[model samples]
Structure formats: structure tokens, C-alpha cells
Target: MASIAMLVFGGNAHAEGGSYNVDDASVVGAGKCQLESWLREWSHGSNGLYAVPACGAGPVEFGVTLNTGHGVYGPGVNPSIKWQLRNGDDKGIGVAVATAATWIHGRQDDAQAYVATTFGIDDARRLMVALNAGVDRIHGESTHSLLGLGMDVALTTRWTLLVERMWTHRTITDQGGIRLAFGESSLDLVVGSERSPHPSHWINLGWNAAF
Candidate 1:
């Protein structure tokens, strides 16, 4: 399975005055299920855990992510749906469309809609590049546009490198990570930095299992 990135915390978090975000564009295959969990710690004393369970049905994928923190806020949940418009092959490109709705215990709700496209850079289709563009609407606030660029390179049969940058509103975040795969599961370690407005840094340790 190819590594898919999940949107950790985004404009919704920012809307609540929090500064953490992760975004990705990979999908579980038809009739497949993916379980992902990660913990993100910020430079400041805030930290949280993001756990998501996603499944694929025909050309669409569905997921729900739960966010729990130990700092300035309570728990939150995000439910999302993604539709694969085109499936990329060894010689072409693939595209998907997604939307997520966020609800936090004491904050306004948020909704995000985006389009993702992936292309194979190698003949074996092991090297891939993905791009995402979207808009996030926070209830009672202004809408913000989101953009992201990422790449996945297979290092070996069971190892891959992941890198990406995401921009939403005036916040920009850069992330780099490695994925080690074993059969139907993988482990990921990621570190990222945020700039301006609320400058901060974070590290994410995660695991992904597919069935």
C-alpha cells in the first residue's frame, strides 16, 4: 500500500488559536481499511494525539479522525470522504476529491474541501508526487484557501521517504518523514516547523495498519 497523508490539524485548529497541522493525499484501496494514529508535540507546551480509521468503498474512501489533547482545549472529531476520480497506473496520473467536517467540543465547526492529484515519476511507479488545493470554512469566520505539495520515494522494497509543505491562510508548515513498511503495516516518524503568526515546531510518531 502507498503511504497516504492525513490532515492532522488545520485551519480549524488555527481558528481555535492553536497552531498544528498535517495534510496528506493518499487513499486506502477498494474494500480495504487503514488505521492510523500519531502524536504531535509542539514547541510550546501543547500536544495532541490524532487517530483515524479509514476505509475504501468502490471509488470513494471514508474516515473519521479523533483529536485529543492535553493543553488548551478539549477533544475534536473530523469526518471525511474522498472520491477517487481517476486511478493512476504505471504510466499515468491519478486524481481524487475530498472533504472533511470538523467539530470541537467548545469551538465553532469547520469544513474543508480539496482536490488531490498524483503522478508517477518512475517507470515502476514507485516514485510519486502529489498536490492538493482546497478551502476551509470556519463557522462565523472568513474562508481560507489551502495548498500543499508532497512527494513519496521508495527507498527499498519496504522503506519510503515522505516530504511535504502545506499553506493555509498565513500559516506555512513543512514536514519530512520516513516510513518503514512490514507487510500490511508501517511506522512513520515526522518532524515539522511552522512559520509566522504562531511560530512553532512539532514532531509526529505514527503507525498505520491496513486490512
Candidate 2:
């Protein structure tokens, strides 16, 4: 019942990775792959299981997001591709173009494309920043322009902080989270809010790994 409600308010369902609502301008690497999964519970009363699996080939990464409502409601899958224009290292600047198409079961389909930039401000502290500008086209509705900004700071060897905000014409969302690194994988906890006609607040716990 609760899952059905929030699935209707699918404003922050954009596919990136990790716990941020905004996508970043980085890819795993050539021949490298990653998997991200999370469990979310909304303050409005709902739960979801989300997964993302992606791999990099050449200058591009192919991925998809799986969003399910506790095995109930389905916005099913979001297929995405990211073309890395510049490496996101401690070099000058990094840039990428990302696009995704969404199909929510029984609901309308939507597609989005965005240009993103990432910068490494402090290599010692592992401080990074990312920004995005995009447009989302709804199947039966008008196109909505989107903007986003995000940051990640490594607080310590095992702990890192993340904050991000994304806005569209119809809705705005913000998220703050932390990651606890354990070698190749990490655990995540995120809390976020969305501003819309019917607001939804959620808490998410996630896992991320690279291979």
C-alpha cells in the first residue's frame, strides 16, 4: 500500500549510482564493473529494493537500474549509458554525458539526458564535486529541465560523506548520506526529502562494490 503511493511520485528515480540522486561524471574503468544495491523506507510509508549493475568497455559505460517496491510495485528497469569524455582523476577537469530511458509499469515512459562535470578539489582528503544539467521528456507531458550538484568528502579512512541536490521544474530533491568502506565494498545510509504537491521523505541503506 505504501509502496504504491510513492511509486506514483517518481521524481528522483534517475539512474546514477551509489546513494546520490544525481549522477556523477565518472565510470568504473575499461573492463571494470560495479554493483550497487540498496533498501529504502519512505517516511510517507513505503519500501523499495534498488539495484544497479554496470560495466565499462571503452570510453563508455553501460548500466541499468532495477527498482522494485518490496517485490510489489514495479518501475522495473532504467537503461543508461555514460560516455566519458575526460578522466575523473586529479588532473584538470572531467566531463561526461549520460542518458537513460525509464518505463514505469502501467505509467508513462520518460527519458533523460544530462551533461556532467566532476572535479577533484583535494586529492589528499579525497574531496570531489560534481554538477549536472539535463532535460527529462515525459511520454505524455512536457519536458522538464533538471539541474543537480553533489559532493563527496572522505572524512576518514573508513568513513565518507555525501550530499547532493537535484531540481526539476515540477519537483526538487535533496539527499545526505555516508559510506563506510570495507575494502572492496561499502555500506551506505541516506536520508532525503522531495518537494512536490505530495512530498515524500525517505531513508535508504545501500551497498556498493567494485570488481
Candidate 3:
């Protein structure tokens, strides 16, 4: 369970400047909750801290994140919701729709709405692929479309690997990470790069707990 949460929200650390990233299509089991926290440091000496607590009820999941950072956009609150449309199985795929709203200090609020799909691959179903496309709206600004692709591969009983690429307008970001699980908790270490005319590197360390 902890490993799953890391896979779902780990790449969120790469989100900077109000850009959206791909989110997982799966949810925690009903009545279950997950807590995730991460610290991100960029090559330019800026850093941020993020914390998210999510709960699943029936076929829907709800989450909110507290973002405190030293960047163009300061502190913020991000709330999100995802509804499971289908559950993945040996013979079928999974789908979900998610939306997130962001309110930043002294800046225009932003929102994103997207649809995501997941497919189980390989004979053991240990490999999964996800794709998402969505629209982002910034208050008093033009809307833009976003696209993302991601994969999760199980390396062992207690290890998993993640890779993802996301595009929003002219900016493209890529992320890769490995998750280590111990009992009901996991740790994720991720490295990512972004191209917004110039290249910048980001490193993230995340901890996830399931309860």
C-alpha cells in the first residue's frame, strides 16, 4: 500500500510554476488513507516541501496537499479528487477522472481537469502503464492542454521503479524514481529534469505511509 502511494504521488515534486503532472488512475482501498510528504531541491538552490493526505471512500478518492516553497509562487493549497471508472484486471483496463485546484499566495488560482487510464501488462501483471491528457486553466489567462505518460515496474517484492514524461505547452519534464517498501511505509527518491527553454534538475525525497 505504501509503495502504491509513492508511485501515485511521487512525481508531483516535479511540478513547479503551476504546471500539472500525470496522476495515477488507481485509488486506495475503501476506508483506507495514505499520507505522503516530500522535499524537493532544485539545481538553482531553491527548495520546497509538500505534504498530502488522501482518503478513499467507495469508488472515489479525495486528497489535499500543502505546498510551501521558495519560488515564483509562494505557499499554496492544492485539493484534488479522483473517481474510479473501472478497475484493472487481467482482461480489462482501468480508468479515472481527476481534478485539482490550486490557490497560491498573491497569484491567480489555477485548476486542472484530466482523464487517466491504466493498463496492466506482462504475464504477471507486475508492469503497468498510464496515460493522461487534460486541460489547465489559470485565472484570467489562456487555457492549455497537458499530456503525460508513465510506467511502473515491480523490481521485487519490496521494490518498484517509476518513469514518466509530461508536457504542458512548451515545457517538457521527465522523471525517474525507485521506491523501497518496508512494512506499511515506503521511501521514494526521484530525479527529474525540466526543459522550459533552459534545463534544470530537481531531486526529491518522499516518504509514504498507509493507515
- CA lDDT of each prediction against the hidden true structure: 0.66, 0.72, 0.68
lDDT pick, better of 1 and 3: 3
Question: Candidate 2 has which clashing residue pairs, if any?
Answer: none
For residue 121, what is the lDDT in candidate 2?
81
Clashing pairs in 1: none
The Cα error of candidate 1 at residue 25, in Å, is 5.7
Report the C-alpha lDDT of model 1 over 1-211, residue by residue, as the tens digit.
2212233353122100011243334467788888877777777768887777888988788887777865734487777788878776344777778888776785647787877777877788677777778897767879889787777788999988887777776777777788888998778887778675767777878787778
Candidate 3 has its poorest 10 consecutive residues by lDDT at: 10-19
**Model 1 reaches what TM-score against the true structure?**
0.85
Order of the predicted models by lDDT, top scorer first: 2, 3, 1
Model 2: residues with Cα > 4 Å off, grouped in runs: 1-16, 70-73, 106-108, 123-125
Please report the TM-score between candidate 2 and the true structure: 0.88
The weakest ten consecutive residues by lDDT in model 1 span 11-20
From the highest TM-score down, the ranking of the candidates is 2, 3, 1
What's the CA RMSD for each of the models?
Answer: 4.8, 4.3, 4.7
The sequence of per-residue lDDT tens digits that candidate 3 reaches over residues 56-122 is 9998988877777666354777778888888763446878788877767755377777877778778
- Candidate 1 residue spans exceeding 4 A from truth: 1-26, 89-91, 106-108
Cα TM-score per model: 0.85, 0.88, 0.86
